[model samples]
Target: MLLLLPVLPTPEFWITLGNYVGLYSIVAIGLVLLTGVGGMTSFGQAAFVGLGAYSTAYLTTQFGLSPWFCLLVGLVITMASAYV
Candidate 1:
């Protein structure tokens, strides 16, 4: 009966969905840690995301850094900003 219910999507669809699910799961877990464990009720998680993204953009575009290293720098900046 369950299998008869409109045969599921193709493997590609499942793979894409899995990718997004994993990405969002990690974000949600981070937020959960911030609010639940750290007891910091921050409504600025998106801001942090934007800051990291922009930092990455700046590092890559202006400094001509490798994407991987730029990401590491971005992570450091984000963590430092959060701690401050």
Candidate 2:
């Protein structure tokens, strides 16, 4: 199945598919780290991701922040919240 990804007809579809796969792989790695290495059950992973997403969305939409600034702000907020 993975070998057939490049055979997709539309280049745009392939790009979108690859983007999703990359995002899911990141989430899976995070989950594995939390559950396996940290010995912790982290059902709140989605919540943390959602919080960061909302923070970035709000900063970009409401304040017209640059993507890099929004990303930095989102990461800071997410890490602070997790630490607390």
TM-score of predicted structure 2: 0.66
Q: Model 2, which residues run further than 4 Å from truth?
A: 1-19
As a whole number from 0 to 100, the lDDT of residue 68 in candidate 2 is 70
Residue 39 of model 1: what lDDT?
94
Q: State the lDDT of candidate 1 residue by residue for 1-84, as single tens digits.
A: 546534765577766786679758977898989999999988799788888879998999998999779978998999999999
Q: In lDDT terms, how accurate is model 2?
A: 0.87
The most accurate candidate by lDDT is 2
Q: What would the per-residue lDDT of candidate 2 be over residues 1-84, giving only the tens digit for each residue? A: 767767867578778888789868988899989999999997899899888878988999999889679978998999999999
lDDT of 1 at 10: 50
Q: How far is candidate 2 from the true structure (C-alpha RMSD, Å)?
A: 4.7
How far residue 39's Cα lies from its native spot in candidate 2, in Å, is 4.1
How does candidate 1 score on lDDT?
0.85
